[model samples]
Target: MIPIYFCHRELLGLLFKSQIVLTDPSEPPLKTVHKFMQKQLTSNVSKPLSSDVIIKSNTGIFFVETTEKLEPSPLAVCAVESASQTYPDRTIYFFMKGLTKNMTITKSSFYKAIPLLSSMENVNILPLDLEEVVQDTPLYPWYQKVNPAKEQYWKHVSSDGFRLAVIWKYGGIYMDTDIVSLKPVQEINFLAVQDYQIVNSAILGFQKHHQFLWDCMEDFVKNYRGGIWGHQGPGLVTRMIERHCGMTVFKGTEDIICRDFSILNTQRFYPVPYQTWERYFQVWNPKDSFNNSYALHLWNFMNKNNKRVIIGSNSVVENLFMKRCPRTYELIIKHASRK
Candidate 1:
């Protein structure tokens, strides 16, 4: 379902023995997979744990930072809605339902938790009407509903609704939890990166009145167009937008002026003007004063050279943000560092 991207360095091999096994025959296969993963992840592998399961949980609210700019504002600064729940920590044991115990060194990473990374911010988990949202969005290749005529009416809508939901709930400048923060975010919506590559959602920003953003989301979701448009889906949206005719409205219009992004979905076909796809990684070698930037968007393959990291307790992105905001960073890091 969802991916859980977290830091896991100190407890690498140790997590294996703490894993859970599913043998319930009544549950669906996907259900079993979810349970197995949940236990392995949220099972609190800590030693001699307490009575409950949760360590920490909070829901940040989103409010308007400034009344002037609403179309595209910093989603987080806009305090909307946020809350969380958790139980005490405890340890448990189980048996393998499939393979033998010798299957050690498994690739048990947090794919589902990665997206929740952005949720760390006081994001408003609004009770949005799933049906309404699904209907307002555009049509994309990935929009699929097995029972089209019956239970999945909103399946046709594009990711615009999802994008809008994120902006409205969590703000644009959202950070994927898996991303290790490196520096202090000087300002909100600082356009650090160039206007290309679908404005990496891993670290993005916009104003509150950024209806243009909604428009962009609408265009991407409804128009079924995207060059590097992720979040709603992978590079699927990004791929479809390329099959367009020539001259198509000064491609940079959206990049430089219009924020819809859909107006210029051809980064692979063009240059990103002056944006450097660096800094959004584990190592940055720019000895010179690093300016004209806000935050790094470790979209994928956190390491620049794609180095095979051991996936430790603190991800590269987490370390980065804490380096910037010590108090805020440490609070989250120190708490998450628990067993």
Candidate 2:
């Protein structure tokens, strides 16, 4: 039996004293009571109170920013806020590599958004210590030997490595900051398909200590390429998928089970391909329902012109913000109105 430590003696007494009548004859009384206690404990401690009062059942949704930028982009903040709203029961963790423990919030508009992001009960804004995250993983040796200054694409390479390390360390979903969450993901272990032949690492879900993630980490270290763009990101995942499940094209939205893990169809995350990312910025006539899609990847990397989402534009992106992330939308409108 897993030992549960209680800080308050009164709370412990109240637990045992509470009437927990089990209707199912098949289930052991003790087991039923234990589950009830666990549920009670989880609901009571929604926010991080103490180390002992941890929410083990609540799945983790992680978003990492490898660059030393304390103030996250508006889209990144929207992604986090949307996820938090979608998964109120689950914990949404936003790790900023540049955020320090003692850092103060400045008066800048960007910095002010941090407090609003943190205001959500389920959202946790934490510091990302790369070295510490990769310590026990297979990527540790590679990370130690790698010189970020020498690497041409260190930002992309480091972000790729950090995403893998964090997911491996704590079993949950890892998504790029650019991607916004639309709904709760049901798959416990799966990878998002970017296209017919490639799988994108923008979003991934797996249990803690999964072999596929470990293999990916090992492959990441073995094939360690800092100079080649997408070599460590999508390229690494695509190669790993081919090795695990062999080359196969998904025809529909149905999930293809690749041994222990599953490969989700492109429509689930990438309904709008990167090639047509402009569709997000353009106004849709009929508007897309995207019933099958769990989330939308704005392809922020592909926005060369760096078009901002206008409140009255009625673009797909603006509508998404208004409906999916109201807090962020309000912030945008508030900032725009001030100017």
Q: Which candidate number maximizes TM-score?
A: 2
Candidate 2 lDDT for residue 171: 76
Give each model's whole-structure lDDT: 0.29, 0.73
Compose the digit string of candidate 2's lDDT tens values, residues 1-339. Answer: 111122221221111112222334343222111233445543344322322133242277888888898668888988988898888888777767776533444334355456777667776665666776677889889988988899988878888988787777667888888887888888899998898888899999888778898999999988887788899999999999989888656566677889888889998999999999999988855659888889999999999998878868889888888988899989755576678
Task: Determine the C-alpha RMSD for candidate 2 after optimal superposition of all C-alphas.
Answer: 10.9
Name model 2 segments beyond 4 Å from true. 1-58, 106-110
**TM-score, structure 2 vs. true:** 0.82
Instruction: Specify the poorest-scoring 10-residue window by lDDT in model 2.
Output: 9-18
Q: After superposition, how far is residue 42 of candidate 2 from its true place, in Å?
A: 22
Please give, for residues 1-339, the per-residue lDDT of candidate 1 as tens digits: 222222121121112232333333343212211132345444545333211121111111122111112121111211111111110121111111122222221123322211232233322211122332233334223344323344222222222334343443334343332232223343433222224443333334454435544445555545443333343432332332333212223334333323333232223111222234333323533442233222333333323454322124243433444444343333333434552
